[model samples]
Target: MNYRHAYHAGNPADVIKHAVLAFVIEHLLKKEAPIRIVDTHAGIGRYDLTSDAAERTGEWVEGIGRLWGKPLPAALEALVGPYLDVVARLNPDGRLRFYPGSPDIARLMTRPGDGITACELHPEDGASLAALYARDRRIKVIDRDGWLVPKAFLPPKERRGLVLIDPPFEERGDYDRLVEALGAGHRRWATGIFLLWYPVKDPVAVKRFHAMIAGLGLAKCLTVEAIWRPVDGERLAGAGLVIVNAPFTLAAACRAAERPLWEALGVANGRLGVTGDAA
Candidate 1:
């Protein structure tokens, strides 16, 4: 509970994760059915790039700051357009002072009748999220443990949507909890799309986490990783997502976005990999 996203709101990790998330939501929208999105560990719905927290780290300079007004290649544009569109809408003045969190991205991409259930355990953040969507009938904000969301809200009545598990990972056994949560959630909603976000500070720990997920034997499970820098010491080099039951188009979309993302972020040794059945 000690983790707060305000400091890292628009970092490179957020850029990659949110870009992929937008693509996933875009694919889901192709179908005419109403969808539901559950954002576990949802931070405040949006962030101010000028806030003290963000300015202190200046991480956005290496992230969205680089892509703010640049033109993207055709392939990269197609993959990240929806996400950028949302960012644009939020910053109508053409300034990049605001950033949307995952829940905000989901809210922007969904259509009428579609809904989002955002659970935030942090009291202040939860209250902020609640107020952000308070007037919107389609959103339901919950103040609860994000890990418990799969068990409590899985197999949504709509039967089709995305479940985003993005924990703080401040506690020991968070990785283990993630695996267990996915297994339990899959058992309850076998067809639901599951997207898990994890930081890559240690290559060895990441490998172990992947092995545990692979042991789950879920079909169509895919691990998409963006390594911005070499994993050395305690610093976060990059981030990754383990997508369960990913859409067939997701792998290509991620591949298309990776090059431009790394180029814009100024990462000379960046690499993108898709592993598992979805590869």
Candidate 2:
């Protein structure tokens, strides 16, 4: 995989995705039952912002750096508190020196009995991930393809949890593979909450994804996207997260979050919107 998350960690898209992810995990804490989190395509748990990769890209400047210490809207701030708190803990002086990937986020909120299975395919990243949480009894790090692992580790042991699929869309076939993965994973663990992340490059691709999910005939499905700017038929200007069996609280949380995030990180010509059906 040519894509190294270190270069893009904490970017605007990561900000939105991780913020919503934290909210979902927080909501899960409300129930007394044990919960597990299965992260497909998990990257290294953490990244040093001063490293060559991160410094070369400097994407965080428009992301976390944009609002690190700013006053956020009360609702958005509350929803993103857990995530920001973790970031703060990582960068104690609030200098934005470290950034956490999804796996780290999952690890951060794991409880005593809670379980987490994170899969990373990149040899280097996988090794770093394994080392990052080696002593954590609640987390399991595996070097393998996340899509295939979901089939083997479905309906997690706790019987209550979330499965996050965040494949690097370096290949065009990813769109098709995503559909297959979702269908297979759902069949194995029908009630499990599944969150799939995708980039919005072409308008047609986005529509196809929407239609694919709608065609699934799943009743409680939601699609939320934050567009930083109009697609120029070139580079990716935005992305979306498709949530299946999403919690009712997430929609409002996402709605309350889009604007502040956009105002903070969006380009001068950018736009932001969140929409979906969840009940």
Candidate 3:
């Protein structure tokens, strides 16, 4: 209940997570059918970077702030272009004033036929989310425990959609809960796409989590990690995403950006890697 993403909305973690999300959504839209997007722990659908909380942290200054209006190698640009395009769409004045969260990204990229379910546990955040898309028939906002959303909303009627379970790790046992929630969701909708975003604070814990995920024997699971800081003790500086049923092109695209993104963030002695594979 204490975690508010406004302070960290466009930080490096968000940049990576939302970029990957946009890339996945782009790929998913290529097929000629409507899809659903469920975002557990969806914060305010969009953020104001100039807000008091955001200025207090100024995290975006080093994150998306470094990428706007910049040129990149065509290859890397193709990977991150969708996300940057969304930001540009919002800030038509040529200033980075607004940043889009996962729900907003989905709203921008998805077609009219697509449906989106945004869930937030925090009362205030949930109200904000609901208000953001109040008149938009394509989106539905739910104020419920995010952990329980998978079972309730899994196997979307569209039968082709993405389930993004990006929880705020404010409590203990989050990793275990993620594994359980993922399993339950998969059991309900085996063919659906699942994207799990996690912070890379404890290398040991991450290693164990990866092993446990591998132990699940998912047919096609990929892990992409970007580290932009030195190996500090239980300090969250980097981000990781466990993408189930990730398109091969999406995996390759993410891997292609891992190093470039690390460099773009303007840092050294940092590392990035993509493990696992999908067909």
Candidate 4:
């Protein structure tokens, strides 16, 4: 795969994905017990919006850009504060320039007892991720296939934490691979939280995928999404997340954070739904 996340960094998909990510990590941090964070398919830990790649897309202009300093409603702010806080920290001068990937978001939230494993299969991205946290003892960067990480790194010794699988979907089998990864990981760590991301193109295919996951028999799960346009056909309509063993409060939180996204991005017909134990 020749995908470099930099080109799409801070786009609408990322806003929802990372917002939910930071939200979940913050929830995991509430416990004093050591928690492990594994970011499979972790991209370069951080991004510079001024880079040539980011400039080519300018997707951030409609993403984090719209929300940077905008005043938000209380509930929405509470839901997305954790993520925006990281963005704010990266832009102390009150200018949007830096964006943190899943690894960086989790790395900053980690306490001494908490540890993070960031795995990136892309060669250059993996090396960049490794060097980004070279001095950070709490994070261990691995260059390996994320699809296998769940099996190889499941049941984290910490016994409690999050597993983030955000593949680029550059391969035809990625959805199948995600299903297998979740199944493999759950078998080893039934209680560990698992968060996965997928694009909202092809509504029918998306629903079929959701049903397939429900059949996997996870105890508790929910699907949260934001659809800016009609979900009638295949296109980059929006973004969605499938979270297994999610917090009881996550669905409501996801709902709260999603609308503001459409509002901020000036998009229409923001459709959000698909929350349930397995559906």
Candidate 5:
């Protein structure tokens, strides 16, 4: 995979994805039960915003940087505390220098008794991730195909868990892979939370993805899309996040968060919406 999350680590898209991810994971923490997180396509655990890769992209300036100290919508503010707190921990005195990837977020949320598994196919990122999170016993970093692992390790021993399928959509087969993986995973563990991230470049792919979700017959599947700008030709200018077996209260929070996120991003026609169960 040519996609290295370092280039886009702290971008607007990462802000939305990570914020929501933290929200959902925090919501899962209400119970006294232990939780496990499986992060497929997990990139480097953390990124230094000052690094050459991040400086070259400078996407964070348009993303998390804009929302740093601003007042967030109540829904988002409430749901994103755990995530923001970790982000805060990474930057003492409230300075944004390091941006945490999915694995970092998982490690942050996981308690002493919790467990985490991160899979990365990219060699460099995988190696970096292993090194970054090496000291955390609760976390396991693997250089392997994420799609295959879900089949091998379904219904985690902890029983309560989340599977994040964040593949690099650098190829056409990714959509099919997502659907196929979701279908197989759902069949294996219907109750396990599954999150799929995809780029919103072409309307055709978006519609097809929606149709796939609709046909899944999952009572609680939810889809959220946030577009920063109108599509330029057939290229993606935004992203979509789909959660199967989503939390009871997350949909409303996501809907309510749209306005502020769009406003903060300073982008026109920035749209966000919910599909599927209201709860």
Candidate 6:
């Protein structure tokens, strides 16, 4: 209940997550049909990088900070452009001050007819999120437990959309919960895209997670991982996303963008991979 993302906003994990998210959303936008976005565990939509919490951690220094204004290879430019465009709009002055969370990213990528439902469990964060989008008719903010999101809102009216499940693993057994939630959601919305995010702290736990998902019999599943450092101790060494029903072109785009992303993030030994049939 006390997990706050302000300290880690715009960090390496955010970079990878948002980059993939941007690519996915851009792909979805290709179709003329209106799409919906459901962000479970959505934090405050926008964050000020100069805030006290951000200053204390300064995590962005190793994340978006390194990528700002940096040139990218031709292959990666298209894949990562949408995300960087959003960040650029937020910091038009060319100084990185504000950082957008998943909800904000969705808002930026979505078209007029598309909609978003963001669920934030933290009371204060939820309030801030609601306030941030109060005047935006396309967005709906909900203050509730993210775990119940599939039950309350699945099989969206659009019938074509994305579900981003990014839970803060502050509680024990969160990994198990994530798998269960995804399975349940998949059952209800078989064709919908599902992106489940997790930290790569314990390799064993991550392996178990992948095995569990693999056993689910999902025909189209891809695991994208960005490992910046060795997995050790309690600190986060990397981030991962299990993408079910991924777009056909997403895997190739991710592969091409991996090296450039790693270099931009200043990680010499960073690793990126796409596993499962979708790859």
Give the alpha-carbon lDDT of every model: 0.89, 0.83, 0.87, 0.84, 0.83, 0.90
Candidate 2 residues lying further than 4 Å off, grouped into runs, are none
What total of clashing residue pairs does each candidate reach? Answer: 0, 0, 0, 0, 0, 0
Q: Would you list the clashing residue pairs of candidate 5?
A: none
Clashes of 2: 0
Per-residue C-alpha lDDT of model 1 across residues 9-51, encoded as one tens digit per residue: 9888898889888888998899999999999889998999999
Off by over 4 Å in 6: none
Q: Show where candidate 1 strays beyond 4 Å.
A: none
Tens digits of per-residue lDDT for model 6, 113-145: 999999998989999999999999999999988
On lDDT, who's better, 1 or 4?
1
Instruction: Summarize candidate 3's per-residue lDDT along 131-234 as a digit string, tens digits.
Output: 99999999989999888987799889999989999989887578888888888998999888899988888888888888889888898888888888765756
TM-score against native, each model: 0.97, 0.95, 0.97, 0.96, 0.96, 0.97
TM-score of structure candidate 3: 0.97
* Candidate with the larger lDDT of 3 and 6: 6
In angstroms, what RMSD does candidate 2 have relative to the true structure?
1.4
Compared to the true structure, candidate 4 yields what TM-score? 0.96
Tens-digit lDDT string for candidate 2 (1-279): 897898899888898888878878887888989999999899998988889998899888888888798877786775688888878878888677888889888877768989999999999999999999999989899998887965789978799889989989998778777888888888888888888899988889888888887777777788778788778768887988888888887787777766666676746755545566675
85 in model 4: Cα distance from truth in Å? 0.7
After TM-score superposition, what is the CA distance of residue 11 in candidate 5 from its true location, in Å? 0.9
Residue 187, candidate 4: Cα error in Å is 0.5
Candidate 4 lDDT over residue span 167-239, tens digit each: 9987746777888889899899988989988877777777778887888988788888778777667568877
Model 1 residue 221 CA deviation in Å? 0.4
TM-score for candidate 5, please give it.
0.96
Model 2 residue 145 lDDT? 83
